[model samples]
Target chain A: MRSYLSRTTAIIGMGLLWLAALIEIYPIILVVFSAVKSKPELAVNPFGFPKEITFQFFATAYDTMHYFRSVSNTVLIACVSVVLSAAMTSMAAYAIVRRKNRFHSFLYMLFLAGMIIPFQMTMIPLYKMMVDLGLYNSYHGIMMIYLALTAPFSVFLLVGFIKSVPRELEEAALIDGCGIFQTFFRIVLPLLKPALTTLCVLNLFSVWNDFLMPVLFLPDDKKMTITVQISKFQGMYSNDWSLLFAGICMIVLPMVVIYLLAQRFIINGITAGAIKG
Target chain B: MQTNLRQKWKINGIWLLFVLPALLFYLIFLLLPTLSATYYSLTDWDGVTSTFIGLDNFRAMFQDRLILASFRNTLQYTVSITIVQNGLGLLAALLLVRAFRGVNALRTMFFMPHIFSGLVMGYVWGFILEPNIGALNNVLEFLHLDALKMSWLGDPSVARWMIVFVSSWQNLGFSMVIYIAGLQGVPRDLYEYSDVEGASRWRKFASITFPLIAPSFTINMILCLIGNLKLFDQIYSLTGGGPGFATESIASTIYKVGFYNGIEWGYGSALSIVLFLCILLLSVTMVTLLRRREVEM
Candidate 1:
């Protein structure tokens, strides 16, 4: 009787998990279906398969939303910010971990403290400063802000990883007449590839999908990121579910592709960060 | 030789060169602005004129009903969503802990939503729950439960709840991932021992499972609290804090007060300061409590 009860419970548990998974995935499926369906078809049968799948909405959304321009902008911003952030954060982490000085500890704590302070506090004044510096509505301005905001977390994560790198490796490099910079670039950075990829993926998703910063700082239409661009599409055609879903599908497809391609690294990075920190 | 000192300086120079760009950006963009915000919060500046009215902005904040309301709304939203999301996450994590087929795919699907922006999710749900010709109401009408169809985003009473539900759905995967990590750290021997003792499932879960996952709960709760307190994108996209400001969060309130509604910069800075302190205090308190609990375990 106990065994039978346990088996039944296991089946019930699995059923619940299946239901949760379906709920999670249904929105993506719904958007795709709605994107292809005709307006009348959407209204008549919201959940049913499209009578005839069409690329009209995709083509319209692509042009109306400036999808390619926004995609390029997102790519440029994410790539630039990731390269700058990774270089600086890894160096700072190397210094702090290898030196182990009082000053290094203090700086490390300063970055950790940055993690706790919410962005709302800094946003208003940051905007005012950007405006004064003529950096407002500029891509470089937003890129600069993204680098600053992302650095602390990247540094925090890299510090932990850097600490794990064997001291003997660096000592060997030094013994072979490699200077600090050479040792760091030729040895330490190569060893830190996993953590660096993790940081890049994390920052890529954040910078690409960020809404508030772009909304606040880059209010101009010409300077909009993809998220802001999609928001504009929604605001303009609030009732056009077909076009809106098409816009959303366009914005999400790249992220979905990236996530699927690097699913293992993303999952491992998240799991590692959660478990350790 | 004097050249050795120059060599040391050159090494420091290289390090400084590597660090200068990031440091300069962070200092100018992040540190300097934060300091200016603190100064502005003390004055009566409205983004144009610079009038120093020391603490009057803060004093005025104490009497501002909108600020108070935003605080209450934020607290309520944060508490409700954090509890519900983490509860659902823990339940999902527990079920998926044991060996199961297709668990990996299920985990992947469940976590996929986190990759999308809150703005996108907000727009998707906004369409799904539109008052007229919406998918939700259409389905409800088709099911013959016509009375169940209410203005989901328009009703003040239900608007906040809808935001809560959407935020929870977006964040459920994040907490689930954390709890899965925590669950894996728990030992198999403890479960086997509990089974051998013929302890009921509820008893085993109560005694063994809950405490083991306390660290995950604490971290998830802290993250949820901070994230919800600063939540603006989802709320902005969905309701724009409409229906009589029923859904105005602290972050949205700050944004409106600062930028949209004629730049009440001083008052907004004050509000932002309040939010910062609130998050800081709550995070410190949570960390202390959780660290102690971790020690006890």
Candidate 2:
């Protein structure tokens, strides 16, 4: 009787999870199916598999959104911002953690406090500052904003991860006549791989999908990111569900593919930051 | 003594150089803007020129009924999203944490929504929930449950809840992932011991599981609160805070008032300050309250 009951419980648990998973995936499936269907077909078979797949809508959306240019723009911005922020913030985090002093501790706390300051609070002044400095509408300008905005949280996470790393290796590196920069870059940075990966993934998510910043700062059509471009495409082609879904799939599919390919690292990065930070 | 002092100074300088790059970005982009926001909130700065009005924006904010309604809507949206999202997340986490076949695949499917931005999620849901040509209504008709069909994002009453629902759907995975980590941290021995003692599932959860995941609970709650309070893109895409301001969040209100509509920079700054204060106050209170529960457990 005991064994039977436990087996039943396990079956029931698995059943519930399957139900939830289907519900979670159904909308996304519908999106993909609808993207391949014509408008009239979508209206008739809104939630079913398409009778035939078509790439015509995808072609139109690709042309309309300048899909290649926008995707590349987003990739360039996200990559540069993540690399710059990770390198700089990791160094700052190491300094803040290792340099045991009142000032450094105070600096650490200041970064922690920075997390609570929302973008809405800084956006107006930051916009004016960017414009005045002739940094608006440029890739490097937005990259700098992303770098600054991500620093505090990056430092916060890296600081937590760095404290767990043993100091003996660094001490040994120093005694071997390696300068502080060399010891940090060669010894400490390697140990910080997991945390840095986490930071880069999370930062990439925000910078890539960011709509408001590019809308405000990078207003030129020549420099629009995919997310910003998609929103604009929607405005012009509001009634075309097929076209809109194709555009959305363009924005979402790359991230989904990356996540599927590296899910273990991505999942671990997210959970690790949650627990440690 | 002189040599020792010089060495300490030299070490400090090296550390300072390490921090200098990040510090410059943070100072110029974040800290300076924040200081200016506070200053601009007190004045009637219309982007170009400003005069110190000394609390006039705050005074005007109280009288603005739109601000008042948006505040009420913001609070309603935040509270509902927090409870519903975390509740579903914890439940999902509990079930998924069990050793089942294809568990990793199920976990991946559940977390897939989080990879999409709020804007994309909003657009996807918006298409599905449209009144006339929407997939949802069409499905209801096909199933012959026409009574269940309603204007999901068209009606004002349902629009706010739809925003809340969409936000929760996108974010529940995050909370679930965190809770799963928390549940994993609880020692397996405790559950095995309880099983030997013949404790009911509820008894086991209430006594052991709940207490152990309190930290995750706290973090998830605070995150949901902050994220929902500042909801913009989702609402922007879903309803545009429309059907007559029925779903305007504090962040959207700031965007429209400060940036979009006539560029009320001073008032927008003031609104943002309020938002920051709300997040600060609520999260601090939540942390304190939730931390006490963790400690007590």
Candidate 3:
């Protein structure tokens, strides 16, 4: 009797899970379907399978989006910003963890406070400062801003993770005549892989999907990031479903591919970041 | 003593070296800009020049009906997303905690929306919900349901809710994933004991699962509250603050006032500060209140 009741519950549970999954995935599937359908086909059969697939929309979207340039530009900014931000913040987090002084504790609090200051609050002054400093529309300039924006959260996450790391390893490295830098780079950093991976992944998503910063600071077509370009493309082609869908496919596909490739790490990374915070 | 003091100075100096890069970036980009923004909020700066207007910008903010309307909209948007996303997320997590076939694929699908930018999601959903040629309306028409085919994003009454629904739809998976992690963290012994005692499912959950996942509750609620309070991208792409400012978020309004409308930098800065305070107060209150609940549980 018990086994039968439990089995029924399990089946019911699985049914609900699949239903939720279908709801989550259906819109995405429709977008992909519409991307390949011809204009007439899209109008007639919006949700069904396309009778004939076409790559012409993809081709047009590619040129109009400046697919390669904007994508590479986005990748450049995301990668450099993620790498540099992680390096700097991790080092700072390490210092705060190891030193354990009043100043370090105060610094830690300051960084945590930074998390409360919304981007909107800083938008006007930051833009003015960028223009005044001649850093507007430049890759490095934007990268610097991304680093600052990410610093607070990165420091918060890293500090939590780093405290769990045993001090004995670093002490052993120090006693072996290794300097602080060497001990840090060789011993402490390699030990921070899980945390660093989590931070890097989160930073990548923020920098890549970020719309406002690039729109405000890098307005030039030559300097546009993928999100900005997609927004622009979206505005211009709002009426053309076929073209707009193709453009969206371009913007979404790369992230999808990356997510699929790194599903385990990405999931665990996000889970860890959320749980620790 | 002199030698020991010198050694302490050397150690602190090296630590300073390690901290300098992040500090410089924070100071120049974050802290300095924040301080300057506070100053600008007090003045009537038009991006080019400024006059010290004292509390004029802030006083003007209270008189501006547009600001008040957007604030109300933002609060509604945040409250709706918080409840819907977390409610459905907790439900999904309860089902997903049990082992089953193809569960990994299901998890992947649920988290897939996190990959798409909000801009792209808004546009895609915008296409789906277009009243005239949208897939949704077409489906409704096919099913002989003409009454359900009004302008989805055009009606002021429906558009705000649609924005809330779309925002939650994009992130429901995220909240699920977080809750799943939280649920998994609950030890199995409690559930085992409950099962042996023949406790009702709701009894077991309320007594065990709910209390155990208090941290996740706090995390999901505060994160959603903070993120939705600063809603921008989705609002920008979906409604552009709308059929008649029906969905203008404070963040979008700040953009319009600061840059797009006429560069009302001073007033924009004041609005920004207000947003910061709203987020700060709410998040802090939630953290303390929720943490107390966790302790009580």
Worst 10 residues of 2 chain A by lDDT: A268-277
Model 3 residue A208 CA deviation in Å? 0.9
Candidate 2 lDDT tens digits, A1-277: 9999999997897788788888787778877898999778887888888998898999999999999999999999999999999999999999998988899999998888888888989998888999999999999999999988898889888898999999999999999999999999999999988778777888888888788889889988999999889889989989988999988887888898888877777778767777775
Candidate 3: Cα lDDT at A147? 86
DockQ in order: 0.69, 0.77, 0.77
Model 2 steric clash pairs: none
How close is every model to the real structure, measured as TM-score? Answer: 0.96, 0.97, 0.97
Each candidate's B-chain TM-score, in sequence, is 0.94, 0.97, 0.97
List RMSD in Å for every model shown. Answer: 1.8, 1.6, 1.6
Better of 1 and 2 by TM-score: 2
Off by over 4 Å in 3: A1-13
Is 2 or 3 the stronger prediction by lDDT? 3
Among all windows of ten consecutive residues in candidate 1 chain A, which has the lowest summed lDDT?
A: A267-276
Q: What tens-digit string does per-residue lDDT give for candidate 1 at A1-277?
A: 9999999997897788789898887778888999999888888888666898888999999999998888888888889989889998888888878766686788788777777777888988898888889999998999899989987888888888887888998899899999888999999999999999988998899888898898888878776789989888888987888999999998888899999998877777777766667
Comparing 1 and 3 by TM-score, which wins?
3
lDDT of 1 by residue, B1-297 (tens): 799999988877776665576667777777778888899988877877978889898888778888788888999898999899999888878777666689888888888889999989888888778878777888898899999999999998699999999898887888888898888998989989988999998998888988898888788888888888898888998899988788999999998998888788888888888998999998999889997997897
User: What are the runs in model 2 whose C-alpha is more than 4 Å off?
Assistant: A1-13, B1-3
